[model samples]
Target: MPRKGMRSLFFSPKVSTSTDSSTSSSISYFPSPSRFGFSPSKPSFSESVMNRTLEMAEPIIMKWNPETTTFAKVTSLFYDNRKEAIVFIKWVKNLQKAMQLFITGNSSSEKLVRAQNLMQIAMKRLQKEFYQILSMNRAHLDPESVSTRSSSTSFLSSISDYGEEDDDEDTRIVNESITEVEDASSIAMADLKLIADCMISCGYAKECLKIYTIIRKSIVDEGIYKLGVEKFSASQVHKMDWNALELRINHWLNAVRTAVKTLFNGERILSDHVFASSDSIRESCFTVITKEGAIILFGFPENVAKNSKKSPEKVFRILDMYTGISNHWPEIDSIFSFDSTTNIKSQALTSLVRLGEYVRTALNAFESEIQKDSSKLHVAGAEIHILTTDVMNYLSILSDYSNILSDILADSPPPANNSVTESYFGFTDSDDSPAPPITRKIAWLILVLLCKLDAKARYYKDVSFSYLFLANNLQYVVEKVRTSNLKYLLGDEWLSKHDSKVQQFATNYERLGWSHVTNTLPEDPTAVRTPEQVKEIFKKFNSSFDQAYRKQSVCVVLDSKLRDAIKVRLARKIFRGYQKFYNAHGVAMQRDRNSAAVVRFAPEDVGHRLSDLFFGTVDSGSGSHSSFDPSSSHSRRP
Candidate 1:
């Protein structure tokens, strides 16, 4: 059963006269010794064999070795003596394969293609012969023999190992003749000077400058564009194409640096001033890129910079915002004044909560010290309440003086550069699309807070190991105040007007300052509501605030007037005070588990103004909260 082309490469010639001995032998295809080594294990799985070989060899093959003088030299030799090399290579392949089959001792049981490699050498085939060879050396091709051959022969040494891993590691020879890369393009300063002089002589000074810019930008990106690839007919300059001008600065690196500084300094300037100033620079420096040759850094903001005319987009985008904030710092100063003595009987849910959490976390860090100090232990809840009240009041009234900001946030939402701006700025058409107004933003915060409280009150009843920490999550409370859903309760048209003065002010608050808002009345202030109406409004804010207190791990404050103000009318004309949240998110409104609380935490004696803080329950009918009952009959004290 010997194949016709068997032993083609190894045997010198084929026997002219075919005999019975050869026929009885059934093709003894004993192969010659192979260069490429192979040693099969005992009847191993073919899949594993192929898998292991491929896994081991693929890595070696993928590695590049361009600096191999040996390979380059061998290429010529291979092409010249192609026949001899091919025959030798086949002989080596066959011998090792046979050796592997012999060692594995797996007698051939399946039909296979002939192992004969070269048609040019011997004119015989090889399927049966290969089987005979496998049978003949099954015992001799053992692990021991294979190991001896592997150790004795320097088989791989002849092949040049000049890749990154092999050449650089084993040998310290740096051959100059074997170059891997071509030389780079070089344009000297002297050449540039000569070119400039020549261009001036030719009455093309501007063209020369334009050419210089093209080279500068392109060189930065592709590194001189490989000297050999192109003809520098006009010197890498005249062929320029650039993006259109937009006052958008994506200086992420600088912004990141500013952020890091703020993080370490804990400064408001870093959060507010940094972004405002950078954005201002970007917007205010708008110049028509008239000539597209060289970028004239000096002539930016063609209209605005050189003269008095300004881009409305610039005002909306940067100038109005930053300059207004910068110049009107006193307004914010007056509005943000905190009253350390006053307790916010009515709270700004999210704001109050965060301060409480911060205090709690601070105390928890040194719980041993806190517990030991009798005064600290006694005043812990009191301090939290006072701080919570202060924070709530401040945040609640923020809407009053920041109407312009509220409008900016609601009507025209814009991208914020820093923390302070990000927190306050709403996405708007002036910025992106009109942002939900600041009041609405606060409303949304309140709604979310209400949802969270509702969820905690409604769903998380069973106290377990996981539920234990639910008692002290002040951050969650702050979130409610920060993200109150005011839009749903207050008509979107009223709360989030695109052309509202509030948004315009907000977009320009930083530049104009807080005084502009504190002194001015809302163009359309919410109509006063009767205490008898909107009872639901008071309830929601109350529940959400209660949740805030609960989050602080302190006893909840169930105020009378505060609870009774919840109703429908107030929901329609959402106020800037604490009642706004109470109406929208506590009971009738949808609740989200992760929603922020309406109020924030701050200690008593912290200065805050009703004019400064908004988004709370206001009893127009009763005029004051002193007349309210704590439990049943909801009445506001005059």
Candidate 2:
């Protein structure tokens, strides 16, 4: 048989005459110069073992001429050794080529079968090498390291150079000292690719891919578990108390970033690199490894949005989840770009959509809460309303997340029937374009609060106090917007417009609050009056001025600047008229004891009394002989 001829040639080394079992067992085949039909020659001691080693490995490709064989002869060394593994891979490639040669040349069917058997043996060895390299080099061939290692030009260039060089040269590169951490990683990756290339080439791709997906899938699953991402049904999430749910959302916030940036990303790179030779395998491997974890990771926010109680407070956490997904969209798109993994991307996008929906719903509920506020309790002293404080605080915090809200509110159209909202938001005949949706939404919420405050202002008995209440509450809203991120969302133009409204309300309050006192003086204070007219005018002025001062001194303006401004305006209106009247009549009235009693206050006293107004203090000064002292009132905060 042809096998007997090959076996006899391997053990018949002429120089190995000593038949000691140990010495004979050490002999290996090495190809000689004359073996390919050039010239027959005997081997020396040094060359004898090498010749025998070559002859032993030659049986697999015996029909093919050795002179033209492109690969190194397969050695008896174990496939586990790095140098021998490199040589083994070379021999597998030669076996493939020899099988092709026999099939093409119409060689003996028995030889073809033998070559097929040899190919299966080579594939089995490669399968073992592939699994061992993946298992033993977990740290060195980690997905993160392997992903980065695939991009190393030095390692890739070394591999390219290995393709052109002899077996010994390739082995030398593999056997070199691994100086860097990635050096060993690159070597492991190279080994994996080599075995994968051989196995897949021999039609054992299913077996190759099965081993890969099983190991890598477990790693990806464990990674998600380590990151604290767990799959939750809608009911499960809905049943969780807000505090527990909040903590889970916080964990998801951190986990999503790491999963997208490092875990799934690293797996993607590793899968693509390991199966670089096959597009289908690359996609299939990455999809299987990452899809399940990614779907669960991204689906969490959707579950929270859909099933959790629609409390207004929960919207903030939903927005936070929306932000987590929106921030990492680029990596999600790139890592899960495969068609097979489109569901992962869809799941993430669904989370964003659902979160946006929750925000819109919560905002509607917030608006309804504002509308339904039925408490008619008057704010004593016309101070800022509780509704004003609550709403402004809410809007101010909402404005802090304007960028996220912008996206969420992008598709929300403004109320179509309300011309007031349209005009307020700058939709005009000249430019009919709508404001940004977030701008409209935020501005609209504020408009609703103002409408509610306007209704509340009507609860005051005096029209003057009503105006003062509006001024106070509106000023609070303006100040809140000015000091917080809301200022940026509602532009300076909106602020300037609202600021003018506050001043107008303040003006209305001052005029109405003190008009009766100013009206008691003559239209022209210089007009000469008889003693009777002067006495009657003084009598009327005393009653009205005392009443106005007493009433207004108890009312409050909380802001110091607005308080001072209102006081200054009141002084100008009252002092200009009363000072003229007192100068016109005081000379005559002072001469009579009865008339001087009626002329209770001089111009200086009037000015001093006006200064004392708006401190929210009860006036203790009797109108009789008390000079208006600046320091008489308590300095308590209003």
Candidate 3:
């Protein structure tokens, strides 16, 4: 007979007896009951055989009870006898059929609740069995502890004159203990996998997830718990079925992704609250998920794609916060009691160096993450170029802070009895001594900013704008370094390189800005000249100069020294050409009374006007040559 409580167990025949003789003759061809068990009677062999067949099939019908049947019971039976391979295989088949029927008969919610309960129970039972196995194996697993207890007990027994000893018996006991531990460990590992499978078969994905979470947590906790008590290998933790764990992790990753989406809200700028919340979530993932598990479950391609899709605005916002914090580093020093020391100045400088180093490290990490897989970043359309430029801008701002810090250090008094020169300048220090911490940090900041600048320049659609932007930032950085103590740390090589870069920018600017004005100057003074031609040259010069001044004046040059140098260069180019033209032709121009009015600028007048070019106060009519004779040698441009 089929097992009790099995609803779908046996197949019953669908044949009916009939009163007609022909029907009975056809039915006789069916298997007789005598074949099953009953002996044929002398009066009627066929009737005896039929009775026995009916009796044999009745038990199958009586045993099936749908109301009393359950998948839980079937699973329990299978696990109880799971150590016997043949019995375990048969029970597993029975449980599978029972689950199918249960699923088909119930609603989805009901099925889920039932499956969840069954899985939870199975996991609990499996855990109990595992502990039991571990207990059985403890003798070999912790032989030292076992032997110590045995020694104490035997010592007491020996004092009482009741101790017994045999070398062969002790050896046998040790070998048997080792064999038992091996068997128990194998059985526990196998049972762990079986329980995991049952959870999967029951369609309890959440329950499976919980079980795996527990396993991972337990592994971590076990190590912590036994840190000094015993040594544990990572392989022991990894002994759980990886394939099953991976499957569950994949499902959990989708949930995590969904949660992350809701947290970000598809927004470019993340608020402080959002940032805090996301950080918490990230910490949770790191806690629960192993690196290998994350790699397999999250996949590098998808993670890279997701990260690349993040808005550049978010990156900028983070950088801005970092800059703001760095700017108030002095305040942080006071709040953190760094100013309490006798060497507060050095402490402040050290703190500033640390802040700069942190910013550089963070920027590098950001760049590395974004550009890890360039192809994916590109495919996802990340604004890597913009991010790079923004990072450079942040560093450029920090370089200004470095200047302020350097000034503070320089103004600070030397220690008692120490020479101001020696202490402030480190003059007495060895030539091979390492650079001051602040100087090295500032050097690193400059290098990283320049590197990012080079990278960002490549993606500019307008190469001229790229050059202009780079020139603006690089000039600012170099000037800051040169004017401050950072110059000593960066050395003369970096200074020369940067100075050349500035000159290149100036050359580009001159070619683009002054070409038309220079082209209008006449090549020869003795050549026959028309007043119309000379007057037209002056007109063109005024127009071009005004246009160039208006455009280039708005361009940023933060350093006063650099700005003054630029103005000097502009004055030289404009006045040198104007002075020559005036010298060669001023006498001829004086031949007409209207020529004085026509000549818009004398050389000295141009020199005076050039001072205001970058100062943004140049007036269009400020350089009029009224009340001045261009023919006087004293009137030549300074």
Candidate 4:
């Protein structure tokens, strides 16, 4: 007779009875149990029955040694004979109970030592099985596959559907094969969880976690490498040229997305599922696998921001990196939420801060470069300056990243100087309709350039060319703003204000470009004159108009619209003004015999010559000189 506790302690399998070998061992251990008890109905009978139970379970426990038959060759233990595996786990528990009973009774015998040895054998077999399952099913148990376990059917169906689009036999077979692999992946996941649960329950979790984390960590590291992520130091990044750095940035942009969305996220999910038995293990395993690689991955941007040489053009790439992190911040936070992995989160955030700082530094340097451009090299034809072209092109490309710049420049104040703020050009700098930082920042940069252009225009000796210089450069700036993403950022109000300035510059150029010609004629065109007076007036007009045409012909106005408008204004003022005076004087001059020498050009010839004025000297065949210095002194402000 057995005690109730002893009867309850015996290992039982719902699916199958004990094997024949286990039965024979039970018979062999029957007499040994009675030797421990004084009578059949003894109070210590439960302890005796437990001792017998361990001995009977020995054959099943040691049946599959890791050294002889590996789990890779055989089917999964839980899948092949779950009942036997369950019985084996029960035997492990019973062995612990038997060891405790022997120690309590102060009877450490051969049975106790045997139970201890059998326990070690069971653990070794389970550890081997765990490692084999993980290793053999590496591809199937990949983090991506494990992550999709919850949606395996839909994922497989999508694969099948994609393959069906080709309508080929090979595709069909490949789809079926993928479906089978997905099925196997599901089984593999369940099997990993089962083995994990068993080893952890038996106090062998260290061995299990060791194997799991090592394999999984290598997979994650490989994933990062394959994505083109590398451990880059600040110095290494600093030494690279902009073009080379730009390529690395692009690679990081692609790699970071896949790393966050798939690699770390999948690892997080897989770790949590595999170690569902323990929260600490889940977090530990995930942290071990992803922390180092994630920090390096995120730290690349920080290194670039900190170490790379600052340039206005380099800001766009930094913004791209910032956007990559910003776009996936939610996933990154969720995946790396564990306290153990908080450094990864902190590193990512630090990269954002560093990138923002770098962008601002580069922008300030750009403004400084514009301000420091002291080259006295006057641009030929008073056309768009190189500074204007480079600055506007930089700003236009910068405008494309306005959304990110807005965030980075949120706290950055506009230029404080009153000259660039609202004076001179009448930039719309009202406090009431406050612009965003990026808009104000861009406006300030333009104003700085405008101020710089004002200085550059002074290099021209002729005040008319100075005004033309301002008009040409300003027109180019306005066009850049209108065509690019800057159009939306600067707004129509900003464009309108600048357009008026351009018109003002044009008016000044029209007034000054041919001032000599206009001022030569009388105010009242129909005034009477003697033949001598009329011929003298005609001689002065011819001299002034010829000088003006020769000088203005070589000057360039690149914009067709601006060029036409200037020509029209000059035609109205100079052509019409001279025509009235010429009409008044021609009859008197024609009566004189010296009319042909005096009245050298008619009004129609003057009008036709105005057409050739603004097309540059190169086009007009007016000598190779693009610009000339006039002796007449005029204020540079024009």
Instruction: Pull out the clashing pairs in model 2.
Output: 28-52, 28-53, 29-50, 29-52, 29-53, 29-54, 30-50, 30-51, 30-54
Using lDDT as the measure, the top candidate is: 4
Candidate 2 per-residue C-alpha lDDT over 1-638 given as tens digits, one digit per residue, 9 for 90 to 100:
14454345335544553689777555545455455977646543323333444343445333222233433223222333556556666666645544554465445565566567666666765665677777777787666675555456244434422433467788677656233323667766666676676677667888999888888888889888888889998779979999999989988988988888878888887776677778898899889888888888999999999998787777787888898899999989998888999899999999899899999999999999998898665455687778888888888888888999999988886666557765565332123665678888888888888888888888878888889989988999989989999888877877888888899999999888888887888888667458888888888988998888877766777676677788777767777777788878787789888778998888877877776565456554732222223434332211
Q: Summarize candidate 3's per-residue lDDT along 111-134 as a digit string, tens digits.
A: 435433443444444444334433
Question: What ranges in model 1 sit over 4 Å off?
Answer: 1-198, 205-211, 219-408, 412-436, 459-638
TM-score of each: 0.17, 0.77, 0.31, 0.78
Which stretches of candidate 3 lie above 4 Å from their native place? 1-363, 366-448, 451-469, 483-485, 590-597, 622-638
lDDT, candidate 1, 177-271, per-residue tens: 11221111111111123223323332334454444334333321221122111112222212321111222111221221222122111212211
lDDT by residue (162-214, candidate 4, tens digit) is 21122254345444544565477765665567567767766788998999989
Candidate 2 versus the native: TM-score? 0.77
lDDT to native, each model:
0.27, 0.73, 0.42, 0.75
Locate the minimum summed-lDDT window of 10 residues in model 2.
71-80
- In angstroms, the error of model 4 at 256 is 1.5
Off by over 4 Å in 2: 1-81, 103-125, 136-154, 157-164, 171-187, 375-378, 414-419, 422-431, 528-542, 579-638
Give residue 572's error in model 4 in angstroms. Answer: 2.0
